[model samples]
Target: MIKIALVHHINFNHLSLSFKQRTDYIEKYLEKILDAIIVKTNISICTEDLLLLKVWNPKVYRRLINHPKVNFLFSTHNHAIPLIYPETFTEQMLLGSKVILDLINPKKIQGVGYPSEVDFPPKISFESICKVWEGIILGESRIKISGLEKDEFSPVFTINDAWSKNKIRGHLSRRAFNYRDYLHKYFRDEANSGEMLLGIQDDYKKYAQGSVLLARIDLEVILFNAPIVDGIQQEPPINKFRDLQKYLINHNVDFLKVADLDKTDYKIPEYRISDIAPCSSENIKWNNKSLKRRVENIKFDRSNKLKYGIWLSLQCSDYYCTNFQDLCFSYGDKNKKTIFITKTRIYRDQESGIKLKLLQGKTLDQIKMNDNELEKYMQYFMKSNELLTNYL
Candidate 1:
C-alpha cells in the first residue's frame, strides 16, 4: 500500500492575526478540515501553536489533544529558524523537546517536526543530536523517529534551458541521496537491530511530487501550508480536496499517522557522498576575484582548525559574511585589557567593521547608533544570531 502521512505545522505565533481572530480562524476553517477527514483517515498534526492555544483557549487544546484520530507531534516552540544552525544540537533538542513535554506528557511525545526544510550537511554533530533526542524521548531504548521536510532539494524548476535544468537536478539528486545515506549510516545500528525511521516531507503538491515518488521514501509526511480562512482564502479548496481524495483513493494510498510507523522495523542501506560521485570544488573555476581576495586576506589560526576554517569560509562566502559579522557581534570578546587573552583576533576586526558600517548609516533597520537603541539591539541581536550560530 502507498502510505501517506498527513502533517500540518501550525505556527500560531507567526500567524498574521490577533488572539481572538486566530482562535476564530482555527474554529471556522481548521476544525472543518479535520471534521471532514478525522473519522475517515488518520492524521498527524503538529504545532508550535500550543503556547497560545494553552493560554487563550484551553478547551480547544484539550479537545485536539484528546482526539482519537489525531496524533500530535512536537515541532519546536517557534518554527522560525532551522534547529541545526543557531544552537548546539543538544541544546536545540532539549529546548524543542521541553516545549512538547510541558504541553503534553512525555508518553504522548512520539516524534519531532524539524523546524526548517534546509538540508543539513552530514556532520557528526547532527548524529550526536539525534542520539540525544532518542535518549530524551525513548530513554534507554534505541528506537527513534524523525520527520524531515523534503522540499529542500527540489522545491521547483523554473529554469527554461534544458541543460540548466538537468544540471540543477543532478546537483539536487546527489544532495538528497547523500542525506538519506547519512541517516542510514549514522542513525541505524551496524547489526540492523535498531529502528530509526526517517520520514521525509512529501506534500501532495506538484513541486515535490516527482522527487518524492523517485525517492521511494519509507514515510511520506504531507504538509498543508495554507491556513483555513473565510471568503475563499481557505486552503485545499473544496475542488482541490476532492481531487486529492480521488488521487489517493485511485493510487491505493493508505492514510496513516506518521507515529504509527514506530511499530515497523525498517532498515535503510548505507550510502555516502562517494557513492554519488560528487563534483569536487577543485574542478570549479574561481572567477570571482573579490571572493578570492577575501579568502586570501583572512588568516586562519592553526591552533583552532575547525573554528578557523569555518571563519575563513564564512568570510569568503557572500551568503555567510553577514552571518560571520553577527556571530562576532554576539560572542566575540571585547576585553582586550584582560590578563589572559585568546588567540582569535578576527572577531575584534569584525566588530570594528560593524561599528564603521553603523557610523556610515548602514545599520540594520532594527538597530540604531544611539546608546539606548544600540544596547537593546545588541541584546536582541545576540539572541537572534545565537538561534542560527549556536552550534559554532
Candidate 2:
C-alpha cells in the first residue's frame, strides 16, 4: 500500500557526447518511454529540462503540448541548485525554468521540481522564495542515500525502490540486491502507513539510447533496463508495473495529485534548517566507522545570513552534496574563509510553493548569468553507496 511515484531526469547525457549524438540519445532512448505514455496508462513527465526534449524530439514535445494526461513541469537547471548555489542562483534557476514552462502551456503548468531534492534553507524558503514565485514545489524523497542509521529513512515523502522491492520477479536475485538491502532495512518499515510523496530517481541517463525503459509511471513505476556501472552484466529490468497496476486496481495505494490533497486530512509540517542532519561539503565516503554519525546534529545561527562568494571549481562536487559524518555547518571562521552549508529535514516542505522573478534570454546560461549576484554563488549527485561506502 505504499503510495509510489516515478521520476525521469531527462536530457542529462554522458559528459563526452557530441552535440549531434546528444539528440540521437534521446530519440533512441527516451522515445520508447514517450511511446509508452500513449499506449500504457497515463504517465506524467516532470523535468528540469524541457528544452532537452523540445530540441531533441519534436514529436514527443507535441504530445505534451496540450495533452492533459501527459503533463509537463520544468524543474531547476540540471545541477543541485540549493546545495551548490546561493539563494539568488536558486531563484534564477527556478525563474528560468518557470519562464520556459510558461511558454509551453502557462495554464497547465503550475509546479516545479527540485534538481536533486536538496533541502531548502529556512531563511531563504520560509521568508522569501515560496511566497514570491507562487508555484507548487513538486518533489520527491528527502532521504539522502548517505543516511547514517535505519532511522534516517523516516521522511514524510518516500523514494520508491521499484525493482528492488518487487524482487520476487525475474529482475535481480535476492543475493545480488542484498547490497541494496537497506532499501528494506531502512526505507520500507513505514512505507505503506501514511500519506507521503513516493518517488524514484534516474541516474543521469542510466537508461541510454539502446537501453530499454518501460515507463509505467501511471502505476507510479518507471523502469530502466541494465548495462549500468560499466563493468556490470547486461541484466534485464522488471516489467513489474503492469502486474502492480492490476494488483492496485482495487487496493489503497492512492495516486493523488497535489491539488487533491486539501480534500484529505493531509498535514503540512514546518521546518527549521536545524531539523536536517548537518551535511558536510565532502563527497560521501563513510559507513564503516559506525552508525553514531546518523544521529549527530550541528548548530547553526538562524540570524547569521549565508555569506556568498565561494566558487566551486568546474565539476567540483568534492565541495558539497552527501555525507553525514563529521557534520560541520561552516569550515574556517570569521578570521579565515568559510564555506556555508545546510541540510533539509526529510519530511517538511513537501509541496510548498514560492514566488520568483523573470529574466530575458534564449539560452539558460544567458538568463541565469544575467543576475550579477548568481555568478558569485556558483558551485553541488544521487549515488547512495558513493556516500555510505567510506568513513566521510
Candidate 3:
C-alpha cells in the first residue's frame, strides 16, 4: 500500500483579539478547512487539538467525533503556551486531551509538535517536552529528526497536489526515501510507501495574510523574496484540499493516521520515511538557511536564561509583543529572519484573575491541577471551559 499522511497544523489565530473575536476568526477559517476535508469520503487527517472544534461548532464536532477517520494529535504545547509554568501548559493539554479523547476517539495519541510551529523557551524544552509527553504519549511523529515545516521555508507555496523528488537534503526529500523526520528504522522495514506524514501549517490567516506562505516568485528576485509580503502568494481557492485528495485518490494513495506508525505491518517498499515525500527546489536554500541559522543561534543564546534550541523564531509576532522582544531581536540577524509573522495575541502573564503560577526548574508532573485553576486558565485560552461545557 502507498501510505501517506497529512497533518493539518491547527492553531488559534487573531490571538491578540478579544476572546469573542478570536473564537470568531478561528471558527470562520476552521470551517473552511473542515469543509474541504469533510466533503470527501474516507479522507483521514491528523490535527493538533479539538478545543476549537468543541468550542465553536457543535455540528462539526459531532460530524468529526462520529467520523470514523478523525485522529487528534497533541501539539504538545501542553495544548497551551506563553510560559514556563507547567500549571498553565499542563492544565491546558490535560484538559484539551480529555476533550479529544472524549470526542475524536482516536485509539492513541503519540505525536507531539509545537502549536503554530513556535517553540517558545524556558516554557518548553526538548527534555521538558519529552518528559511532559512520555507518560501520556505513545510516539512522536518527527522530533527534530527533521523540521516538518517545508511549506513555510519554501520561498513558494503550492497546493502540493503531487509528489516530486528533489535534490534538497535534510530540508526536503532529496532521494526516494523522503520522510522529513522519523526514527523509521525502529518502526518500518519497507522501502517506499510514498511520503510519511506531510504537515501543512493549516491556518486560514497564514495563507490569507501571507506569512507562512509566499507564492509565485521568480528565482531572479532573490533580494526581493519578501517573506513578509514582498512575494506573490497563491490564495487558496475554496475547497482547497479537494485537489490534494483527488490527486492522492487518483494515484491510489491511502491515507494513514499517525497512530498507525506504532503498530506493526509497516508498508513502505524501501524508503525510510516515504519514497514519495516531494522536495522543494534549490530556491529554498536561502530561506531554509536563514531558519537553520536562527535555530543555531537560539541554541546557544544564553540571553533568555532558558535553554536555547527550543525551536524559536522572533520572526513570529509573538516575540515583538512578548517580553522576549529584545532577546529575539538580538538573536535574529537582519538578513536571516524567516517570515516576520505577528498578531496581537492574548498573552498569559498579561491577563488578570487566578494568579498565574510559574514553574521554575520543575517537571510537568510535579504540579497538581485543580478545576478552579483549569477553569480560569481555560477562560483565557478558550473562554470558560468551552471544551468541557460546550462539548458535552
Candidate 4:
C-alpha cells in the first residue's frame, strides 16, 4: 500500500512583519490550505503550528482544533530558537509541552515535531526531553514518535567540507535509528498494541528519495512543504499544492493520521541501534576541538544577573517574553551564568529590537542602567504584546 503522512512545521516566527503588515493574509492562507487539503485528498495534515494560530485567530483555530483531519503535534513554544540547549529544556518540557496539551485538552495530540531542521541536538538529549513529554505532558495523549528528515537540515549550507558532511549524515541516520529503537524498547510491554512513529521527510522528486529505503523501513508518511506567504510572494508556489494533490490521487495513496498508526497493525521494520555505524573518531575529535574553540572565544560576565535576563527578554521579544520571569525563578543564582552562556549560543548573531550585538561580550552591568532601572526593565520585559490578532 502506498501511504503518505503529509506534515508541516508551523513556526510563528515566519509570521513576523516580513510576512505582512496585517494578519489576515496569514489567516486567509491557512484557511485556504486546510480547505484545499480537505477537498483534494483524504490525507490528514500533522502540524505543531496550531498553538500560535489559536492566538492569532480564534475562528480559524477552532476550525482546525475541531477538524477531523488535523493532527496536532508537540513543539517548542518559540519556533525561532532550537530546543536542544540545556537552558531550553525547562521551556521545551514545561512551557512548550504544556501549551500544546492545554490547547489540545480533551483531544489527544499524536506526535512531536522538531521546531527547525537545524534544531537537532544530541540523541540522548532528545530522548531525555521525549521521556518527560511521555510521562508528564502527554496525559491520555499517545504520540507514536517524533519526525525528522534530511530536507529539514538541508538549510544548513555551511557544511561544505566532505568530512563534516559525512559525519553529520552518519550522525543523523544513527540518531533516527536510535530513536526508533528507543521507542520500541521503551514501550515493549505494549509491543502488540502500539509503537512510537518516527516520520522522516522524504520527497519522491529529491535525490535523497531512497532514505526510507536505505534505512530498510517503509514510507509511512510523505509531507509536502506548505507555502509560507510573505505578502510579497507565495512560497513552495501555489501550484505545488495542486501538483501534490494530483500526485497523491494518481498514486492511489492511502492517507493516514498519526493516531491511525497506533490503531492499525502496521509496524516499523525492526533494527538494532548499535548495529548502525558510528561516526569516525576523527570527526568526533574535530567537533570537540571546534566546540572548545568557540566556547573560549565567547566571554561571559558573572556579576550582573538581571542584565542577562533583560538582554534575553529583549532578544526573545514576543516569542518567549512571558516565560523569562518564570525561567529566572526556576534557576538558581549559580545556574544563571550557565543559562546566559547557553543563551549566547542559541541567539548568536541574531538581530534583536535593541540593535546591539547581544552575544558580544557585554554584561548586564555594562549597560549603564541602575538596579531600579533594571528592575523596571524586567517588569516591562515580563509583559508580552499581542502576538497574533483575530482577523477572521
- Computed on alpha carbons, the lDDT of every model, listed in order, comes to 0.33, 0.29, 0.31, 0.33
> On residues 192-303, what C-alpha lDDT tens digit does candidate 4 reach at each position?
1112222222332231232221111111111112212222222322344444445445544445542332232333232222222222222211122333243334454524
User: For residues 107-190, what per-residue lDDT tens digits would candidate 1 score against the true structure?
Assistant: 555553343222231233344444323311111011111212234323222111232221111111122332244233322111
Which sections of candidate 2 miss by over 4 Å?
1-7, 14-25, 38-48, 65-67, 125-128, 132-224, 227-247, 250-252, 258-263, 272-278, 281-392
Q: What's each prediction's TM-score?
A: 0.40, 0.44, 0.40, 0.44
Q: After superposition, how far is residue 215 of candidate 4 from its true place, in Å?
A: 15
Q: Model 1: residues >4 Å from true position, as ranges?
A: 13-23, 39-48, 83-85, 88-90, 105-108, 118-128, 132-251, 259-267, 271-392
List candidate 4 segments past 4 Å from native: 15-27, 39-52, 80-84, 105-108, 113-115, 123-127, 132-243, 258-351, 354-392
What lDDT tens digits, residue by residue, belong to model 3 across residues 220-274? 1111111222333222233323444554465545555433322333221122223
Q: Which stretches of candidate 3 lie over 4 Å from their true place?
A: 14-25, 38-53, 74-83, 86-93, 106-236, 263-383, 386-392
RMSD of each: 18.7, 18.2, 16.5, 17.3
For residues 141-225, could you state the per-residue lDDT of candidate 2 as single tens digits?
A: 3222333233222123222223232111000001112112222221222232111212111210222111211222111112122
RMSD of 2: 18.2
Better of 2 and 3 by TM-score: 2
RMSD of 1: 18.7
